[model samples]
Target: MKIAAEDVTPVAFTVILFLAWEGACRLFHIDAFILPAPSAVFAAAAHYWWPLLKNSFVTLWTTVVGFILAVVFGITLGLVVGWSRAIYRGLYPVMIGFNSIPKVAVVPILIMWFGIGEIPAILTAFLISFFPIVVNVATGLATTEPELEDVLRALGASKLDIMRKVGIPRTAPYLFGALKVAITLAFVGAVVSETIGANAGVGHLMVQAGSNFQMPLVFAGLLALAVEGILMYALFALLERRMAGWAFRASMSAAG
Candidate 1:
């Protein structure tokens, strides 16, 4: 019953939040241009449903494509770095430097090169998200117990054998955790890039609406983004629990 109540808490709180927002707007007689109520946002969404759907699809695909690339590249690079102390040390600083730079700044350069389209958005998503995966995966492998490694070595296990038998499997939880984070970052990157240059997307739609003083439509675009982001994040959270159930169980046991 406690677990069930805990599960309902977020939904309940979200309902309360929207109710409060609507009441506040009504009580203050807030200008719609400044802060459209949830009802106004929903009405705008229903009215512009088709454009929202089309642009949302565009954003979704771009984010997914970029996230897929980030996963493949991040996992492969992480494995290579984690395989050796020297390589990891040498590459770590470079990766830090790269990740520290704002991805929004990179968008203009991408636009210049790609000439305003989905490609830039995809690349932006890839660049923004790949770092966390790389860090988490490499950390997972690098933190493998030295005592265990010695035991494996004593049993005549090679480095490759240890990595295949232990390191990769141990990193599964870390990889999935990073995926949840990276997927959200990927959405941010795609939207940022689209807002900067793309001809179509939720970001672009919001920009257009804002310029036209259509605050309700602009807020509706934001609502669309929030819904999509929540769904994607939830999907990965479910995947993490499913794929790394052992890790979850172990952590729960440890906590208990």
Candidate 2:
């Protein structure tokens, strides 16, 4: 099969943007300490490949663990709240309040409670990423059409049956959308935890580099993070397409 124009357009644009960035830095003779060229960043990554990749794995593991916890708790609570007006009325406000809390502000407290270790890091990631999943999942469940509910009811379907067959299937796309956002937040939480108190991981490396003014290494760490985020976003996007193919197809048709 041949690549479509639509696909090639984005790849071309990305290449152009990268070239522009590389060219601008070189043309301006920017200081390495201030803004190193992309080439330098790539060199740095190659130089410290083993250590950087190890740190990346540590961060990746923490992010994945936190994401799993967030999805489990968020989906369970979301389903309960969505299915019951009484539960929603009583708990929505509290959930909203918790989400409104600045995640950064809670880092110190998290450290104190969970210790300056991976637990705090994972908990921080979970907390930061959970709200979106909860809200999106609940919204997906609660927003089912009245006509659809009526049709199911007329078919003698029980509440549990409706939920399992209709609600969850419909809600999956939104759940995956929430997952895309959650992945980035999880990474941020892990990095923040490592930067503040932990000994290993990319965030710790970044902090150490910054203190010593090792600009190239700092840029290298940042590049690693950016690549990780892109990979995660791509992974979620692919999964969404696969698991929610009907929803994706409908969306595409609508857009077209």
Candidate 3:
């Protein structure tokens, strides 16, 4: 079963809000320039469909790249730290300090280093979004049952064999949990970075729309971004359901 509330909730809420918004705009005789009705926003989006999709793809690509990097680096570093006491002790403090710093504050430096393009946006997304994944994965890997470890060792399993047979498999759920969080942060980070210094993306389009007082266009851009985020989230949820079927079933059975 889907972990999410049924899609009907958001769909119904959106339909009702749009109807209310349009009615309010008509009743108040609001000018389209101020707060355009949902209809007007849809019309604008329909008219600009191609450019909107193009810009969306640009942002989507950056987000995807950043997310992949975060997962790879986060999982790698997490495994290294979790499996080695020395590295864990040595790097834990530095990781905490770096994570404490506001990632957005480093955007200027990122741009200075990588220039105002996809690279900077992607790097910013990776930098800000990777810490949680790493921390959670490390914790999960390290906190496995000590009794299990002892049993596996008595059975003559080597360190590598134990890690392969037990550690990573057990940590999959935690890694995916972090993926859920990382995906959203990755989206936000990419869009925010693009907004700060991008010439071509949905964020850039929204900035342009705001500058020209196109509130409907701004709303439309935001709506598109929201849709993209929802789609990404749903994709992850679907993958999780499929990949964790046994675990999810076990969870459900236990809960019941």
Q: Which candidate ranks first by TM-score, i.e. highest?
A: 1
| Residue-by-residue lDDT tens digits, candidate 1, 96-193 | 99999999999999999999999999999999999999999999999999999999999999999999999999999999999999999999999999
Q: Which lDDT values do the candidates have, in the order given?
A: 0.94, 0.88, 0.86
Compared with the true structure, what per-residue lDDT tens digits does model 3 show for residues 122-215? 8878988899888887888788798999999999999888888888887877777788888888888888888888877788888888899988
| lDDT tens digits, residue span 1-256, model 2 | 9989998997898779768878988999888889877788888889989879989888888888988999899999889888977997899999989989887788889888877878877888899999889889889999999899999999999999999989989999999999999999999988888888787889988898889988888989988888898899899999998999898778668652
Which portions of model 3 show Cα errors greater than 4 Å? 1-7, 23-34, 254-256
Top lDDT prediction, candidate number: 1
Each model's backbone clash number? 0, 0, 0
Query: What's the CA RMSD of model 3 in angstroms?
Result: 3.0
Q: Is candidate 2 or candidate 3 better by TM-score?
A: 2
TM-score, cand. 3: 0.89
